[model samples]
Target: MSNYSRFSRRRFLTTAAASGIGAVFLKGCLGNPPEPVGTAVTEQVEAAEISPEMMPETTKVVLGYIPIVEAAPLIVAKEKGFFAKYGMTDVEISKQANWASARDNVTIGSEGGGIDGGQWQMPMPHLISEGIITNGNKVPMYLLAQLITQGNGIAIAGKNQGKGLGLDISNAAEFVKNYAKTEGRKFKAAHTFPNVNQDFWIRYWFAAGGVDPDKDIDLLAVPPPETVQGMRNGTMDAFSTGDPWPYRIIAEDIGFMAALTAEIWKFHPEEYLAIRADWVDKNPKATKALLKGLMEAQQWIDGVNNTEAVVSIVAGRNYFNVPEDILVPPYKGDYKMGDGKAEIKDKMMGPLYWKDGIGNVSYPYKSHDLWFLTESMRWGFHKDAISDIDTAKQIIDRVNREDLWKEAATEAGFTADIPASTSRGVEKFFDGKTFDPQNPEAYLNSLEIKNV
Candidate 1:
């Protein structure tokens, strides 16, 4: 924990965007069998060298993470000695002040006194691959894996007295759109960064209901950890982010969850494991080792009877800093909407983790990246260029390392059930919209409100 640093809301930088990422992992996997399970998250595993000569070149590696349950896999990997088991002896988990710091540090890389790899948004790696964002020293990044799927990622109608649920969101969009049209003003909403997955989720939902997110609403950048306080102080009307905050908002009675991103897109890929591309190119084996460890943690997190322990581990002061009780409900699949509505505990709404050692909720899918790139273009990210599928494919092909995760899963014994294809075909949204990865431009044209 020596790598940990204290964060302040005062240090947040603003940018906004995000996207659904990932395809799926194997049906079984491409391996033999996994090792036995450990009890505690901090329990160290007995070291077993993968090969007599294959040792990680870097003994210690620094990774940045926002202190949230979404970052659980990374923390769990370190705590459970998976990193050590996979040859990364000195894995340091550093705390970031906010998404801005995370983006900055990851961009700089360890060579520039920044992070080597960390849990990041799905769209960031795409931005990095396209050179829209870069290391302070100009190093690109690789999207190695999509760590987790969807869970309450988009919860609009959280502000402005909007009904927090149902198909009436069009009304709120109308209200905001009408406000913008008549009064020449915008309703303010909050997000963790200027452009993150949260922002895209917010924008997509608004656009689906006939509102132009860019013009009708003011999207404010509030750090995820502080978003609840921002809402409490009326700094924002609504916001969406990873766990604790969503449930925390409901618990605090400041707002209600409008729509869970899971409901929007049942299997929306939320976060990714990204690192400096140059470092990864130099240390592919080390990168694979880290992926192997994180995959192990992913299996543990979604295993049956493991939610409580995971909640406790991440809720620790060193992690999310939230109390255990607040995390229990979400871990248990009960999302209290806080609008006098019943708790939603559907498995899809819960953290999309590997349950009972079987599930592809965390695989880094090329199709997921493809969808994300399309959304990136729609929101004006390098809109003049790189919006087309060919450019997006080039960036994704260059950055997305689904093959690494597959190799890691195979080596880690997730075998006999590897996904036949890296693409998951066309995925449908709650609004009856479907994104066919092969034809992303069609999906882009299908949308009524977009940047281009």
Candidate 2:
């Protein structure tokens, strides 16, 4: 039996009509004028009081999702009703056409059921803050929660068959040393959004290897779904995107694994569920409830036994729409190119689970934002950029909603004291270096590839 099974409309009417005073109280709760006299006033009042907590029933939230395996937690959340356990009854996951539509549906959608929020790629939060997306509206948003730390890998066309550039070699740096190299010499790279995680990762990776990505590579904005085809047609040289695309490319022998973004900044931050800053401010309670449900959903998706179950549900005809084989392929780092002679091993694919996974979901630490911001400037977003401290604080204050996150954390049974200031906890990047937000200039100066 379900909780709603005993949630009778008649019982509610009985309570609402117990007295004239009770009727008035119910009316106040309902916030409306009386309906037609023939229609039961008490019944209308009860129907109007149907909040998820009040009914312990359906709580539907519309989410914007791209048809990819990274959306598995959302799929599991919907199918297993993890959301319901958190006082959310109905949760709707809508497959979006692409990252742009997914983003716009939230920032620009009218009341008729747009995305409440969904998985947003990194650097996007910065792009959004910089007013780079559709409408140019500086609709500042908050990352109330994270979905995964990292789920992207770089791939190179296997047909090139030259072992391409190696991560360990300095010679690889010259592949795209100048924009002219890709002119009639087009060395294509694909990203879902021009300023998204794929773009940021590729740019930073090349920069770390001593190459200026913006001036060297001919970047093509292709959907993740088309990345493999783009590579196969020789329209792209390499691309960095979230899974199934990387795995699918390897499985088809069209591309070889270049490197994982996590390798760049191990356990690097990836995707998050961001909300408009005004929305978080106006509806703190609703925002908390939504994050609580998402936290529950993430936990469910990361449970050991639930991996197969998640893959099965997300790959359904209406979800990711990919075959099961491609959906649940082993993530233990075995790269299979066409010749069956090349193999790379590493711990790769992961769904967000707070404090549990290798790259656990955490508050968008300020250092992470700084790293991306520096990269953005290195590639050019801020001209004569402000002090790293001021910019980082501004971005952290605007892009991460700590108050709302702490509220949701309390409801979700997490007890850590949410930091009261913009200061991020200690951060360690891949080169065995640490960044202290309290003093960021020294850290920025230490990086091998600081912005111009």
Candidate 3:
């Protein structure tokens, strides 16, 4: 007998009414809500056809996620029954306090009251695998898939508005470079974490305009909420982070967006879905099941008419815990860039999951991993671990699990969506710099400002 079978209808109703959850109890008793139109029915059919042998090795796993737009697919998979559809009924999507807490938790593993794995910043899995960020305690992780593209940017405090702090800070590079001489301190900036995606974005923006990130400004790792408060108090000059934190900056009148990551590098890789390698090796079938659920959730979020539903689910109290209105604009690609800048209203310039301008957003491309490591080398981050291009390639080969993504895609009947190669080919940035996976050295040498 099931757990629900132990509850008599009369007793259940009485208890629910006493707790003021009568409506919720009735809804649960009626079964799941009706599926949406289009692909949902087909997805239901596919899930219904999953045989006994195809079931996952385990039904329970704890996953951690920060409350950013990048974590939408993980949240959607849990809320929309995607995980359950794949035989992962007890999957838990735990909310992480911040990136630091996430790192600390994953270091302990789920059995120790930490998470198995979930969303992560670029190259974190690789860094963790090599023990670069974990203080020499290597926690080998697999880069399962890319969670999102774009939906991030650099936000400037209101006081610095109209100081040429826009996307191209070339005209105002000297003003930023000379802050210490004039203001008696270096211009302050912050990112959510150090030497990762957010840090790289702000650093790239500064370096592109001839401002040395190391010498021209003071960049540090600060949490989003604290960063916002600092901006309001005129202590933080700028910050790099993902939505809806950046969106909140504009909504609350604290600052204006300097540049969207979309403009910096269109359809650039953002966060990812990665898991501990030990957990994955112990439960291979369960890993694939998790991928299939995430793939379905990604497709569901990419639907043209499902933006409102996406916002409603992710912005709930259990997830992002933010207002739906704040998330809606970015989902629609309707950015109201303040500081007298023109608005960006293109749908393609927002957060994308399954696919983007270059194609196959979910596929964990090895070339992308190489770029992150290469960027790390450029900044001399973890110089001893990621020594050179060859070392970076070796790390990419060891950590990037594109083969797993392919297998899961085939099992999920999404083979057609898979890319022909691991490399996305040559990538172009807004500053007219190109990174060809074939020759990363050339790209690094072409840069005007770099540590290496």
Top lDDT hit = 3
Model 3: residues with Cα > 4 Å off, grouped in runs:
1-46
Winner of 2 and 3 under lDDT:
3
Candidate 2 C-alpha error for residue 52, in Å:
10
Best by TM-score: 3
Off by over 4 Å in 2: 1-60, 110-113, 175-184, 330-352, 356-362, 382-388, 416-435, 447-451
Provide the lowest-lDDT 10-residue window in model 3: 19-28
- The lDDT ranking, best first, is 3, 1, 2
TM-score of every candidate:
0.85, 0.77, 0.90
RMSD vs true structure, all candidates: 10.9, 10.2, 7.5
Stronger candidate by lDDT (1 vs 2): 1
**Tens digit of per-residue lDDT, candidate 1, span 1-452:** 11113211121110001111221111212121111112234344565445634455564677777766778888788766667676675676766666666666666566666678788877876676555765323447788777777755544444455343343377556666565565455666777765668888887777888777777778777765466666676555668677877777777777777767777777678888898888888887788889888878888888768888787767776666678998888766688776565678665567766531234766777898888778888888767547578988888788888888788778778875456788878888878888998788788888888877
